[model samples]
Target: MIEAQGLTKKYGDRTAVDGISFTVHPGRVTGFLGPNGAGKSTTMRMLLGLDRPTAGSVMVNGRSYADFPAPLREVGALLEARALHPGRSARDHLRWMAASNGIPVRRVDEVLDLVGLPDVAGQRVGGFSLGMGQRLGIAVALLGDPPVVVLDEPVNGLDPEGIRWVRTLTRTLAAEGRTVFLSSHLMSEMALTADHLVVIGRGRVLADCSMPDFIAEHAASYVRLRSPQQAEVAALLRRNGLEVTDVDGELHIQGRDAASVGELVGRQGLLLHELTLVRSSLEDAFMTLTAASVEYSARQQTPAGALR
Candidate 1:
């Protein structure tokens, strides 16, 4: 439902997003993931037509977002929680937005109820908590019932309950054949909430695939072995050209499967206390992929404290 063709954005001599392209399809949630300073926000801005791209363009439903007759009715976005007026009651704020967009006042209440903010509709936004503010923002986004919904860091400051609520809402929206494009740094949450993922690093597209395919391709499956004769097992595995590491008194063998390791250990008559397969986590896989692209990595040590 959304597509970007070589989208690029620059500031002075630096490129915030460098000629990256990806797509968001309907009937599923597409997660846009990247570490801090990875141009996720910039790309979203360009997609929403809030920021002009230095090159290329983005389209919503085969047309530029700017060309849509009624943008709110075609594309709904909560880029941040800037949709609310601090002094206006939630109901009044939504009412005004609806009125300005030619949307019915009834939609304001329907969306408020849908987002679980009906009870506090009369309360001023200034008195709302962060989660409440997020809910209010979501209500406005859904006010138009747009086919495409784009949310950036929707759960930035939400409590666990609020986070789950957002997750459920995202899945429900996708289930109903709506296009849900979300950007978040929470890999675990994305793993659960998104079926497809687009990973970006250093303002470039790092990986884009189904969630399961992404994990299987980037994450390694290793055979973990433990034996009291740790040194012998390590030597044996190394001689067979397997990369092995001894951590916390257990031997970790990479590049080999469980059956192969079991067969080798049995042939060598090595007494094995434990042996199992260990799958690399999605977080680890992501870190490994983007480790080199990290713009500013923390230092492990500092200059010798000026010789104290």
Candidate 2:
């Protein structure tokens, strides 16, 4: 497990990270979400002991990262997939990293196969494609078989198949009771992969909750209905104190779920054509929650003036 309490970071006069606290527990995948420059990378750096926090503390397992005798064995991180030497072969790269951390060379091959890079293990990293480079980075992170894994944009250059593989890999790691903290900007992928979410905006903790709870709290969920007696059904719903909106001849009922809406319509003897509970999507919820927190927003440009 990873525990961060009042973590903060500063660079000169600018504060990169505010005091934020969140816990990443074992047996689940926790997604770290934020827009660019929201201090996500800074927080990960501090967690790995790459950068010193201006205030507060972060612990991997039960102690600070620096306190571990074998840091790599306690936490495996893939912060930057291209942080390897271009001239070194994938095998050589892993071999050296394992040697430095006192890990067995055989473990290198195991991770290579685990990441499906065994065929290119002897190829130079400079000649590898973007996806291949990402695979190598993953292999490096898994080299120590650490219980805590922190990955930043693990699917950056991956194809659809590679993305699916990564999703399964992270889930499997969590299923094995390992603590998995994955950071990515892909909301659709996160929705599929993460069991929990930790959303940060402008260096502050915007939300920390389960996936379903986050969506329900931040975005609107409503029941959509279509009926031959559309006008009557809408009027009835409104009189019953439910807010209803008509769009393209369909009624969107708010403040009630599908079952309640259906029951109300049935009791009124209204024949319904369609009814669906439209739960807010993860992307929708994220946009709504972070609308005000976006650092760089593009303003709409007015077309050439025609009048006034």
The lowest-lDDT stretch of 10 consecutive residues in candidate 2 is 299-308
Task: State each candidate's clash count.
Answer: 0, 0
Model 2 collision count: 0
234-286: candidate 2 lDDT, tens digit per residue: 99999999999999989988988999999999999999999999989999999
Q: Which clashing pairs does model 2 show?
A: none
TM-score of 2: 0.93
lDDT of 2 at 52: 97
lDDT of 1 by residue, 1-308 (tens): 99999999999999989999999999999999888889999999988989999999899999998887678888889987855668999999999888878898889989998888889999899999888888888888888899999999899778898899999999999999999999888888888899998989989999999988888888887888888888988899899999998888888889789889989978999889888998776787788788877888987775798558
- Candidate 2 positional error at 104, Å: 0.5
Off by over 4 Å in 2: 267-269, 300-308
Candidate 2 root-mean-square deviation in Å: 2.3
Q: How high is each candidate's TM-score? A: 0.89, 0.93
Residue 128 C-alpha lDDT in model 1? 91
